[model samples]
Target chain A: MKLHSLMLAAGLAATASMGMAEKIKVGMITTLSGGGAGLGIDVRDGFLLAVKGNDDIELVIEDDQRKPEIAVQLADKMIQSEKVDVMTGIIWSNLAMAVVPAATAQGKFYVSPNAGPSALAGKGCHPNYFNVAWQNDAYHEAAGKWASENGVGKVVVMAPNYPAGKDAITGFKRFFTGEIADEVYTKLGQQDYAAEIAQIRASGADMVYYFLPGGMGISFMKQYAGSGADVQVMGPAFSFDQGILGAIGDAALGVKNTAHWSKDLDVPGNADFVAAFQAEYGRLPSVYAAQGFDTGLLLASAAAKADVADADAFRAALKEADFQSVRGEFSFGANNHPVQTIYVREVVKEGDVVTNKLLGAAAENHSDAYAADCKM
Target chain B: MSTLLLIEQVLNGLQFGVMLFLMAAGLTLIFGVMGLINLAHGSLYMVGAFAAAATAAATGSFVLALVAALIAAAAAGAIVELTVIRRLYDRDHLDQVLATFALILVFSEGTRWIFGSFPLYLDVPAALAGPVTLPGGIEYPAYRLLIIGMGLAVAAGLFLLISRTRIGIQIRAGEADREMIGALGVDISKLYTLVFALGAALAGLAGALVGAIQSVQVGMGEPVLILAFVVIVIGGIGSIKGAFVGALLVGLTDTLGGVLLPEFFALFTEASSAKLIGASVASMAIYILMAGVLIFKPTGLFGGQT
Candidate 1:
C-alpha cells in the first residue's frame, strides 16, 4: 500500500507537468463559408501556421457560417464537450456580440483574432477576455486622425447600419474635425451603391470615408471609380486589405487607409511572418492573418509561462503580452485590448497584384477610447 | 431632397427594379410551369457569374462572357432537371425544397473548389465605363443604363415568347393539364426541360451583367435569390406580367424608401439614429408590401386558383 501511494504521487507530478503544456485545447470558431469567409479563412490559415507541428497544443475548429446563433452553439459545444482552455477566431461583429459575452461570463478565456465589439472594450469587458486584435475603433480612429492631420475639409462618412458601423463612425468622428457633409447608413451587404455614390457626389465633400468591409467594399470601390467622381477615398484598412484588393483593382490605387498591421511592416518578426505565410498559403497574408498569427503566438507564450488551468496566472501571463507581434511593439491595455502603432498605407500596384504600401504611422501606441470605461 | 436628386433616385429605383424583374421573371416562370419551389435558383445565378468571370478573364471579351453565362447556366439547369429535379417533379414540395437546398451547398463548394476562395474581378467594358450626365445633369453609370434597357428588352421578349409562339400554347396547356398535354404527345418532359433551361439562361444573363458591377464571388446569388422570391410572392406565383409589375413596385419601394425614409425620420429624431432606423425599415419595405398585398389579394394581382 505504501509503495502504491508513492507511485501514485509521482504519477500525478508527471502528468501535471506534461498536461499543463500539451493538454491546452483551443476551440477556434470562425466563418468558413459565406460572404465573409475570406477573412475567417485567412485567420484560420495564419493560426494553423503558428501552431503547425507544435506538439504542445491541440486545436478543434468549427465553421460558424457567419451566423451568430451558430457561433453561440459552437462555443457551447467547444466549452462543454471538448473542454477548450481558450476560444478565438470570430469574424463579424454581430457574431462576436452573441458569442463573446456568453463565453466570458462562464469564466472561459477568449482571445479574439478578428472581431472586437465596442461593448467588450468597456463595461462588458472581462478579466478572462483579451483581444489580440485592435479594439473595434482603432483603425477608424486612425483614419479620422490622418484626415484631421491632412487638413481634409468636408467629408461624407458612411457604413452599414449596425453596431460595428456605428462604432466606426464614432471612431472616425472622434478624430476628424471638419465640416459635416452627410452621414449615410447603408444596408448591410448592399450590392448597388449607385444611390450612395450619387449622394456622395452631390454632397460635394472633398473626400469620402466609408466602412463597408468584405464584398461591399469591392462593389463600392468599383462603382465609385466608375462614377468618375474623382473625390479622394479613405477608409479603415479592412476595406482595402490584401484579401479583396485584387477584385477592386485600379479602383483602390492611391486610396489612403489605416491598419494595425501590414505585410510590409519592415520589422524582422513581420518579415519572417510575411515570408512564412506566403510560403505556406501561396498568397499575401492579410491583416486578419497577422492578427491570427499574433493570437497563436500569444497563446503559446502564455502557456509556456503558466498553466491555463490557473486562471490568475494564465491571465497575468497574457497581460504581459510578451510574444513578438507581426505588427511590432504590441501591448495590452488595462482593458486587455491591443495598444499598437497604427500605420497608414497607400493602395499601390506591386507588379500585377494590388496591395498596400506602408505610408507611415498614423497613430502611435494607440489604445481604445473606451478603455477608461473598463473596470478590470 | 431636391427635385433633381429625386429624379435621379427614381432612375436608380427603376434600374434596381428592372434587375429584380429579370430574376423574378425566371423564378416565377419555373414555379408557374413546373410547380417546383427551387431554392437552388440562386446557385444557378452564381454559376452564371462564375462562368462569365472565368470566360472574361480567359478571352477578354464581355460578349463572350455574357454568352458563356447563358450557356453555362442553361446547361446546369438542364443537367439538374435531368438528374434530380425531374424526379422531384412527381414528389412533394418539401422534397423539392430539401433537394434544392442541398444543391446550394454542393454548387457553392464545387465552385469554390474550382475557382478558389478569392473573388474574381470583371471590369465593365470600356464603352460602358464611367457615368454619362443625363438631361438634368445627373451623372449615372452607362452600364446601369444598359442594364435597365437590357432588363426591359428581356421582359418584352419573354412576353412575346409566352404569348405569340406555339411553344407558348403548349406551355400554357402543360401548366393547365400535364396529363392531357402528355396524351396530346407534346413531349412534356422535353418542354419542361427546355422551359427550365430557358429560365436558367435568363438568370445567368442577370448574373453576368451584375457580376461586373458587383464582386464575383461564391454565394453571391443567395441575397438576390431571397429578393427574387419576394418579387414572385408579391407578383403572384406564376404570372409573368405579375412578376414584371411586382418587380418594379419592389424595386421602387426599396430604393425610394432607402433614400427618403431617413430624411422623413430626421425631422423627428437625431439624423444618425433616424438614418440607421430608416435604412433598416427600408430593407423590410418589400416584405411589408408583400404582407399587405397578400392580406388583400391572396391569389396575388394575377395568379389564378387551380
Candidate 2:
C-alpha cells in the first residue's frame, strides 16, 4: 500500500511541474490610484471579466500610480524579475511611452488596453507593440468630421495642453474644413473652466469642440452649461463618460459627442456585455470597460491558439486576430493598432441616467493616416 | 480684440482668483502660527472631500456632508499633530517637506484602500444650478457666484476672528513667541492642536465646496494644494490678507492668460500655431506671475521682514 501511494504522489508532482511550465504569464500595469484610478479600475475589471474561467494564462498586476517614472520601474521589474511572457494594461500615453519600448526591445509582446499615442501609430511603431484600442486621434477625427458635415461653420476648439491634446486637435482638423474662430489650450487637469467658457461664449463661433477627459471634462461641461452659450458643444467620447454622468447630470444633457461604443449599441455582443457588467457591478460599462473586455478576449484567444510555453507563438496567434471582440469584426493593422469603426454619439437624457446614444457610424475599420510612416 | 470678450476674460480671472483664496487661507494660517511647512495640507483637503462625499452619500443630505467634512478634517488635523507633526516642530524645512510628502503617499493609498479607487460625484443643489445674466449680457453660473460669495464671507469671518476673539490673542502670542507663551503657563500643546484643527477645518471646507464642482476622487487635492502654496508665497507666507490678495491675483492671471494668450498669438500666426503657442504659455502663466512677484518683492506681498 505504501509503495502504491508513493508512486501516485510522484506522478502527481510531475504533472504539476508540466502544467506550470506550460502556463503563460502576463504582467498588467495600470493607474490603480490617484486621479486616473476610476478609469484604470474599470479597465482592470473589464479585462478580468474577459479572462474569467480561462486557466492557461496567469495575470500579474501592478499599480503605476499614474507616474511615468513608476511605470518604467514596474516595466523593469516585470521584465527582469518576473520574466513575463507578455505585458499589457497601460491607460496613459505617457506611461505607455515609458514602458512599451522596453517591453518590445526585450521581444516581449506589449498589448495596450487604451492610450493610442500618435508616435506609436506612426514611424515609431514597433512590431511587438499591439494596441487593442483605436488611435488616440481617431475618435477626435470623427468628431471633427461630424461637425464639418453637420454644417458647423465657425468653431472654437479647446483641450488640455498636452501631447494627447495636440493629437486631438490635429484629429479634429483632419476633418473639420470650417474656419476655426479660436483655439484655446488650458492647463492639464484644470479644475475650473470659467475662463474658457467665457472665451467660447464671446468667440462668436457656431460651435465649441473640446477634448478634456475625466475630471477636467466634468468641470468644463458644468461651466459650459453655466456660461449659457447658445453655441452647440461637441467633443470626443472621453469628455462625457459614465464616470461623469453622476456629476454632470442635467448639465451634460444634449451635449453632442463622438465615440466607437455607446451604452446603447444594438449589437448582440454589446447587449450581453452591458447586461453582464450591470448585473455584476451595478453600473453601466463605459467605452474604457469595453476596450478592457476586448483585451482579455484577445489574450485568451491567443493563449488557446498557441502553447503558453512559447511566447513568440502566442504573439503570432494574437496578431492573426482570432478573437471575437465586443466591437464586432475588429482587426489590427500591420502597425498593430486596431482598425475599427468610429461612432458619433449624442448625450441625451435616458430616464434618470445621462447616457450617450449612437447617432451614426463613420469610418469602418479606419486605419490612422499616420500608419504610412511606420516602417514596421 | 472685442470689448465683450475682454470683459468676459476679466470676469473669468476674478472667479478663478476667488477659488484660489479658499485653498490659500488655511495654508497661510497654519504656516504663520506654527512656523511649519505642512506639505500634507493637500491630504487634509482630500480628506475633507472624501468625508463630505461619503457622508452625503450615506445621509442623503448635502448639509450634513459639509458639517461632517469640517469635523472630520479638524479631528484628523488634531490627531496628526499629536502623532506625527509634533515630532517635526524642531526639524529643518527639508525634513518637514520629506515627511509631509510621505504623508501624502500614505494618505492617498489609505483613501484608495477604503474607497476602492472610483470617483464619487457631488451635485450642486437645485438652488444654485442655473445661470444668471451678468452686467455684460453674458450669462454666468450661479454656483460660481456662490463660490465667490462664500470665499469673501470666509475671509471676513477669519478677519473678525483673528482681530476680535480672546483665543485669537493667544494664537497671535503663539506666533510671536512659542517659548514665552509656554512659560506663561498656557497649555501650548493644546493650543497648537486647536490651531492645527482650525486650519484643517478651513481646508476641509474648501475641499467639500470644490468637490461639488469637480469629481471627488483620490489625489484631487494635489493641484489645489500646489495653487494654495503659490498663493501663500505670493501673499506673504503667514498673512491672511496676503493669501486672499495673492489667490485672486494668481487665479485671474491664470484664467486670463489661458483665454488671451491664444488670441494674442493669433495676431501673429495662423489659428493652429496660435493655439499651440497659447496653450504652452497659458500653463506657464502662474509660474511667470510668481517669478515677477518674487523679483519685485523679495519677501512676498504681505510677508514679514526677516
Q: After superposition, how far is residue A371 of candidate 2 from its true place, in Å?
A: 1.6
**Compared with the true structure, what per-residue lDDT tens digits does model 1 show for residues A103-156?**
988889999998888889998999988999988999999999889889999999
The number of the candidate with the highest TM-score is: 1
- The C-alpha lDDT values of all candidates are 0.88, 0.82
The deviation in Å at residue A171 for candidate 2 is 0.4
Q: Give candidate 1's error at residue A172 in angstroms.
A: 1.2
Clashing pairs in 1: none
lDDT of 1 at B91: 91
